[model samples]
Target chain A: MEYQDPEDFIRDDSFLLYCSGKAPEATARWEQWLADNPGRRQDVMQARELVLYIQAELTDVAAASATFRQRLSPVSDLPAPVFPLWKKMLGVAAGLLLLAGSFGIWRYISTPDWLEVSTPLGAVKKVALPDGTQMWLNGGTTVKYIRKFRQSRQVVLEEGEVFFNVVHRADVPFEVRLPGGLQVQDIGTAFSVKSRQQISDELLLVQEGKVLLKKNEQHIQTLEKNEGISIEKGTMKTTAVKASPVSTSGWLTGTVALDNRSFSELGIALENTFQKRVIINGEQLKNRSITITFSRQDNLQQLLETLKLVYQITYEISGEQVIIK
Target chain B: MNNLSPEMDVLWERIRHDDAGAVVILYEKHYTDLLTYGIQLSKDLDYSKDLINDIFLHLWEKRRQLKPVANTRAYLFACLRRKFYQQTGNKTQVQYLEDELLQSISAQSIPSQEEMLIAIQHTTEIRQRVQQALSKLTGRQQQLIRMRYYDQLNYEQMEAATGIAVKTIYNTIYNAMKVLSAELKGVPVITLLLFYFEKR
Candidate 1:
């Protein structure tokens, strides 16, 4: 080997093998090479250390293995499959049949406990409850209720937005559950609920009747007609805003209005309307409030272009995310 | 990396013949490296771990019909990369990995006010030192180092892909390693090892 500098030693395959304690022959050859040139001992040590360091930097084999073993332990202990394909299929079919029979019996005996209705992205669906109350679900909204709706009219808003026109029933109160354990109890009136994953605030807008807002069993506020409140997670304070009729029910009529809302607020509104994630990138741009009104029929591209012209900002649409810069 | 060692080949043969002990040996041999590589690709430790476990479980399920793989490590890496790409829908930007490594280095060099505040609260001196050392290398040098060490591509393969001569590639790697070794001289090996392990 034509050994030159420390660089030459560092690049040598044999030297690396020796450094890793992998090849006895290479280790012997390197030892003899160093012995022949005693002055090269320090350089060889440095090269060896460098190789070891590089290898060490690549992975922590021991720690990774320990974690992996802990995860794999339970899986490896599972017994191997002994049944043939047809036997497994038969077993699965029998199990399913038994489950179905039991479920049918359970359903017949019980009141079926819960009913869930949901709308996909970019879709608005109108649903009529058993009690003749009407619900208009905005895009990507889910509403869950007990099957015994006549007894207690309580519905949970899983995500997105919904508007409810509750039939006046003085005996039973209608309650809508929002995220973060907030609830809106309707007092024989119509209201709208908007809670999207991307937006931090859960909004409740009263269009026709009065509703009592509760958080963790404590009464927060009583909202009346043409009134709305927004609740954030982990906060006791609710922001009250005077609601316009368009703000609550305009989506049903294919219109959207923003009254000097921040860019982030616009992002949330656009996300709800367009069924796409709107990411406001710049911190300053996120807080810059803008007022705009557009119809639900307007394409996202047109809306983004309008925003670009109005706000002097730029946006890039990548797959599902619209990045506002 | 060439393929299976003679010892690994023997184990693979036994695993193919329905040997549970051989399967265990194979799993033990490759799990850690696969996990580390998976974490690097996905940027999610728990997801990476789950994916790795799924791969192995899949292997066990289909062990009887499994084909002979010349290089099990390379095959595993390919499988992991494909699965990660499928799940994330992210085009793996080869250049971005190098840029991230470089940025981590520069970020260490000129600690932002926020980083300085974080450093006061947490002891991350070793990680900073290692990153600073890595930042000392040029982008090409860093890329080559990663391809050679982390990707485990041989010099000939690297030369073929990069159109650089084998000798020049060797020289570049050697020089990069020298710079890193010098910059990271005083740092404890244990600290460096732990840092690398922790990130993965």
Candidate 2:
């Protein structure tokens, strides 16, 4: 680390690294080298200054926080953002709908506390939440929320899967509770939550924004756009998904794109979509990774044919069960 | 630059890791170029300034999801261009989006105001000599020098930036520095450099 020439000091990348606040060890070494050889101070600083000459200039070079000071409040001073009064408007709209006899009088009286929305097999339905979130329920999925959204925006994903294009609010969290103590809270984005009896707490896929995932009310993970977490049995893994953008809008478009998923997982997806028992027979193939895109309009037999053509796998359909080998 | 600093990737990594200081460096590093390009496209100084700010704001907001980008200039230019497009808001036609109009954005741009400021600052006698020395350096030398001295890129990163060899970068910068040093003749180069800016 001894340097005689000023050019030698300049030639050393560590010198500039120290100059730009990079590589702390280099800074320490430069500090030591300067202390040991006090005479090199002018040369080192001069070389460093030569590099600074070419530094780009800015109209405003304030610190990052100061630059944004006039526009966005500092994180500490940021009061919770209050959204438009959509919920109150929704209550009025619902009352009008009630007067128009959209709801059966008996049904409205019985479950005035909880409103429910569900989709049958091979069906995709969109429900507008009281808070202005556009929720789309996939086949065989059920979601329930408080009828009027009193305390906070929360939904219970009791069965199957659901996607939400949330109207983001700063303080009022939009949470989806699932079985096995799994919950997903939207962090200003469109996301999905899934829960199944077999898989327990199944999946949390973020389409656009971000979501915080928790298990049994404890914070587990935060997922961002095109990021997802899959839970099987009791194990969970967060992943930065490389699936195509087509997959982000898959369920609603009736085009399901599964990337690097196991055979059994594919079977579970098939069961959810078709409402049939999808059994993967081989232990070797059960965990084999598969990536495919298929339309929901395709029958079970047609999908099996696709699997046969692309993956070279055969399947046997017996009554309501389709077993892949 | 032949005097390569070689640290843009590392800088970008720090920005991705929520290093506010790193992002500030990135902002200061590219802000002028971005504004120049923005103004060329939009033809509005205030709008261009807003677009530059918006680019950095989006960068900070989406830092966590950023993919690894090798070319910082291309990346920022693309972001700035995107912001310009968004500001124009559905052009009456595909005017700027066309490659010719796109090229016009840069082709029409002259030496940035910063370069003009550098020129004005070189009016003093000693600085005029430095400027003379600077002018004598080849175009490649000036570019490599700027990337190295200003951008703080190392030899390898400079190689990545210019597709020139590290040894070549070293030699080009070495030759350029020799010219500057000869002109200064025993003056600490930093003193002249500091004095040159101090006049501002």
Candidate 3:
């Protein structure tokens, strides 16, 4: 076989392949090419030397060691992360509760010296009065009085929820007096008072213990445990309250239970627990009722998905806003 | 009778037989030397280790199918060089992660601080120019370069990972390399390649 130009061999990828010992057929072709051009053997030798020179520096041990360690370390007896998924969820829940409690306290501090003391939606307030009696104001709930609790612990309920841990002084009866002549007289066990306000009329429910209610200087009724009363058109009627716990004070438990409530009302409920404004875009969804029990520990996606199913409503969520259609 | 180097012949034989022992043996013999030389070329130890590791790991994994090596050391070194260039390219995500992890803990303790800082500043300058140069390439070429050098993807393996054709992989890599060679002249490929090699 005649010698091919070493330059031609160098230019061919097969030549590079043969020099690198990559191609099988190229070996026979390289021998023929080497015989054809004995003068070029030194170039092949030099190329081979260059190839070896480069390869001598390449190492795999570090990567192999790293991979081996990475795959093994998880099963090793090292201390696992303290803040696991559940703990993170608990932390979030606790944060929400503390925020609700703080907002409750804030509302009390900001209450003006007037006939009414009420908090906006999602505000929980602790009213520490000059007289030592305490009022835990629930969100969107109001309390008004004509002349303060001078005659008797007298205050009218307008809207939302309140838990009164009243300081019982047998002489001064702590009374959470309500509109339409409805009044709840506490014999001093810690109890919550709730009244939902509307365009007209209100709904009131007692969560725990007992309270004596009255209207227009006439004895009306006494509510005892899981009992509720509705007041409309100057008439207060007692009704059997659903035996469910109120989320108003459930912050301590890290969960908020919402019984059957309209989407509008649920918006208020979420706003209180989440400590953010939850605006429902559609008037049509206002009356759509839903029952959803959620933990502040729950992810936002899960909460939204559950609401989507409960109301048969589709929603678009971005950050905190959930637009329901 | 064989003109090939003894180490190359042994590696080829061991690799052909699926011997993990040979992989380890090969790595142990070459690792430090390659690492040292790679470090010299880029003045960055991490970069050198990274590039060197990639070449060996590739050889280890694909040993059974690898083409015969006349000079395994040179082939490995060439692979390292290509890997180093790839790593040092502008598309490296490794630098940020490495910096983030090491900056707090080892940046102070590590011996290569001044060298690393100089390399980083130099790299940052080259990276801006390379990004501009790389912008001239087609999307396919850019993607191919990213996968091959940046992701350390080989031809057949890249096919498996991306479900793309094997033939297309070579074409992609070739076109990308050609464009890079042309447009990125005078830019430091060795440092970038070394940087790419060191990434996790």
Against the native complex, each candidate's DockQ, computed on alpha carbons, is: 0.05, 0.08, 0.04
Residue A180 accuracy (lDDT) in model 2:
47
Backbone clashes (count) for model 3: 25
- Compose the digit string of candidate 2's lDDT tens values, residues B1-200: 11223588888999787676677678776665665445334433334556676777667656778898756655677676556655444442222133434333332333433433343333233334445666777889888876664333446546644668989999998787667655544434445434433443
Model 1: lDDT of residue A18? 57
Residue pairs with backbone atoms closer than 3 Å in model 1 (clashes):
none
Question: How do the predictions measure up, each by TM-score?
Answer: 0.39, 0.38, 0.37
Candidate 2 deviant stretches above 4 angstroms? A1-112, A198-201, A216-218, A235-244, A271-279, A282-288, A297-303, A309-312, A317-322, B1-200
Higher-scoring candidate on lDDT, 2 or 3: 2
lDDT of all the models against the reference? 0.63, 0.60, 0.52
Best by lDDT: 1
Task: Assess the local accuracy of residue A211 in candidate 2 as a C-alpha lDDT between 0 and 100.
Answer: 85
Q: Which stretches of candidate 1 lie over 4 Å from their true place?
A: A1-111, A260-262, A271-279, A282-288, A299-302, A317-321, B1-200
Candidate 3 lDDT, B1-200, residue by residue in tens: 12456765777688667665566667666565565445434444344554655676566545557788665565665565456555553323232123322332222223233344343344345445556666777877666554443222235445544557988877765655455445544444433444643641
Which lDDT tens digits does candidate 2 get at residues A1-325?
A: 5566565555565675554432334556777887987877777765544333323221334532244432222221222223355334444555555456544211121144777665665666655465545677777677788765635888888787787767566668888887646788886666776675544336677766678987777888777777777666455544455523345546565566777777866887787567688888777788788887665567878878988998889889888888888
- Backbone clash pairs for candidate 2 read A181-A216, B1-B144, B4-B153, B4-B154, B5-B152, B5-B153, B5-B154, B6-B153, B6-B154
True-structure lDDT of candidate 3: 0.52
- The root-mean-square deviation over C-alpha atoms between each candidate and the true structure, in angstroms, is 26.9, 20.5, 30.7
Instruction: Assess the local accuracy of residue B38 in candidate 1 as a C-alpha lDDT between 0 and 100.
Output: 53
After superposition of all CA atoms, the RMSD between model 1 and the true structure is 26.9
On residues A1-325, what C-alpha lDDT tens digit does candidate 3 reach at each position? Answer: 2223222222343444444332334545776866987777555543332222222222235544444332222212122323356334433443454455633323221122334566776555555343434566766777765445444666667676666544444677777765555667776444555556532334445544566766665667777656665455345444444533443345323355555556776676677777665677777678665676665556766787876786676767667666667
